[model samples]
Target: MLGSLFQKFKDGLRKNTPTFQKFFGKVGGLFAAKLDAATIDELEEALFAADFGVETTEEILGEIRAAYRNNKDLRGQDAAKIGATVLSRVLEGAEGQFSPNPEHHPEVIALIGVNGAGKTTTAAKLAWRLQQEGQKVILGACDTFRAAANAQINTWAERLNVEIVSSQHGADSAAVAYDTLQAAKSRGYNVAILDTAGRLHTKGHLLEELKKLGRVVQKLDTSAPHHRWLVVDGSLGSNSIEQARVFHESFGLTGLVITKLDGTSRGGALVGIYRSLKLPVYFVGLGEKPEDLQPFSTTAYVEALFG
Candidate 1:
């Protein structure tokens, strides 16, 4: 299962890595062999095309150029070495903060996003991860407006063997969330993962519904819903940024969980999101399976992207 996820990551990297046309025709052989300005430009374009984004690519190229200026003797493998170094430097400190606070009582995690953003799936995956850590979890189906939403959480609950609190369809989601928190308290569950309805970010009514859910959770534990995660489909490209903006404005998102990353070529959206929101990327969904939901690690991600 995980092998396929890793393979997809590898495939994305291979497809996006420096194209043969630029690498072989323009940059000479694997050995650096003293590259000229034109060759450097080609290399830069290749990285940008690979979705490294212009700023990241230029920063990397700048580092390579600076290194070359200091040591003119640098050649084929030397160029590759410096290129990798620059990439590593650019992505060096971009690590993920995936560890949820186990000490916090009822570590409430409220997952929110637009329809088809993979919010329910991510909630289930996160709940599974928490259960694996030996924490008793309660899955809260706060998306009461959608019939399938309740069934979705129930399915995950059965599969994970965790308890869930849900209500009838078209019920007040905030009331569901409130009742769920009390249930978690009474049942002594260590965590509560609330799955809110998925609506277009432009929908004011739906967005206000999420805010109300937040207020309800806060009423119970004050720190309830400690984490408001926005699940984004990486395949949506730049639109993910706009979606995030709407959610952040409405719910004050704490972090992001990007899904379908392996299926998209515009991986630059990750960088764009970080640049635009400055929120930590908590996790990424690489595939459809539960286990395919992998914790986001910026270092390993850069390596996989350049592989």
Candidate 2:
């Protein structure tokens, strides 16, 4: 199972693997030749370039340097193993877990994030995945702020053969959320994935709107929205760490869904984000297919990232 998952990550990251490997300070999945001073310097530069952040980058470099000093015969692959081990340790307990509570007829998952973070698409994909897992699912289109939000979600619902609840543009998003949960409960749906409007983490008013939506959701079932996930743009590098921090502070994120990773070389940004937020990464967008949004697996991730 882990092997297949690793293959999926490799497939997802194949396009950027060249640059991705460099970001790890590796010369082709291994060091250029030997574990020497020049190689160590290159690794540090690569780690920084990949946005590993100072703490993680320093830890990885320190481990490799220590290994190199103790054993002069340490090889490039050996160093890569040490680095991957450090990364896996830092991201321990990052794999998110979720199972709908039967008492809560329709477990709610509110997808939160700023604009262009792939919230809407993730909502549809998540709904589809849950439905495939035999959980009756409904997508709540609460993103009434973006003009194209309705059209986009509606298209996904139709294409994926799933149900959706939406409102007119500029309408009260909270009201729409209420209606969606109401539909889910009445229709016997087990999961309600709400794709809320994107809010700039810096804007208090926008955050207030999200809080209102959360409050409204709880009125139906105090635990209706069981998962509050932040959908982050993985390509944003260390800036994404700040985004996660701010959203986490205001919205109280339960997990994360990193998207657009297939397009970026700075894949180390994910490690930094996790190190800073410590939030479980529930899902990661690997491709455009519905199944491409694979569940986060630390083992698979470290293997793929370093390889």
Candidate 3:
């Protein structure tokens, strides 16, 4: 039973990762026998194509080249192992950690990002995850900027049987957050997850509105919104780095939750985002299912890509 469950977990992580697996099949050998000049070039190109970023790509290739120089017969398996080691080193300390603080009753977690980054679905998934762990979680549909946002979150709240606080379209989003936290505190809820509007991250006014939401929530618990996670679309590759930087500058984001990795060919962007901001990745959308929103695991990620 345990083995079957573990295999299913790994299969889920490998969704749409066949390109990578085919490239580095069976321990290694995208090329035959020995590491030659042409094979080395191919490896470099593959890493770059996977969106490993220039810095990381160079580092991995540099190490492999050095190894080849030492041993003219350096097999692809050895080279692949070396590349995975370098990547694992770069992604060190990138996993996020969290626990409900007893002092901060109803610790707030604000999910922020641009539209189509899967914030609403991620919000619902996270709420369900927390509840499964016995945390009294409540959803806060604080995205008053879009009417559909309110309706979508409401639907998930009903499906998950989780309580939520929301307002009409164009209502004050900060006010919704304030009320959500207040309700969580009064009713003894352990955590309140706030689903913020999909701010474009470029508009000055939109970011200012995000700042206001933060300030308003602090009035309730001072340390409310303890987890300001920026939900990013992994398919955008390094393009997401600049957007995340903008949100981080304005909102002082605490962590990241990268979504859409289940289908993105450029899943390596997670490394660039972490390298740029040094924020821990709290969760990743490995698939569309609610159960597929798994916690960030460096081991699982490197294994999936390198194997």
lDDT of 2 by residue, 1-307 (tens): 5556446545545455454454443445445556678767877876777677899989988999999889887776777788789998999889987778887778889999888899998998888888899999999999998769999999999999999999899899999999999998899998999998886345787789899999998898887578899999887877888768888998898999988766566677888888888899998887677877878878878877675
In the range 113-187, model 1's lDDT, one tens digit per residue, is: 888999888888888887887888888888887798889889988987778899998898999889888988888
Q: Give per-residue lDDT, candidate 3, residue 160.
A: 87
Q: What is the lDDT of residue 102 in candidate 2?
A: 82
Error of 1 at 17 (Å): 6.7
TM-score of decoy 1: 0.84
Each candidate: what lDDT?
0.75, 0.82, 0.83
**TM-scores vs. true structure, each candidate:** 0.84, 0.92, 0.92
Clashing pairs in 2: none
lDDT of 1 at 14: 49
- The count of backbone overlaps in candidate 1 is 5
Q: lDDT of candidate 3?
A: 0.83
Segments in model 1 whose C-alpha atoms lie over 4 Å from true places = 1-7, 16-39, 68-94, 100-103, 200-202
Q: Number of clashing pairs, model 3?
A: 0
- Over 129-209, each residue of candidate 3 has an lDDT whose tens digit, in order, gives 889999999889989988888999999999988899999998999999999999998999988999988864458877888
Worst 10 residues of 1 by lDDT: 20-29
Q: Answer with 1 or 2, whichever has the higher TM-score.
A: 2
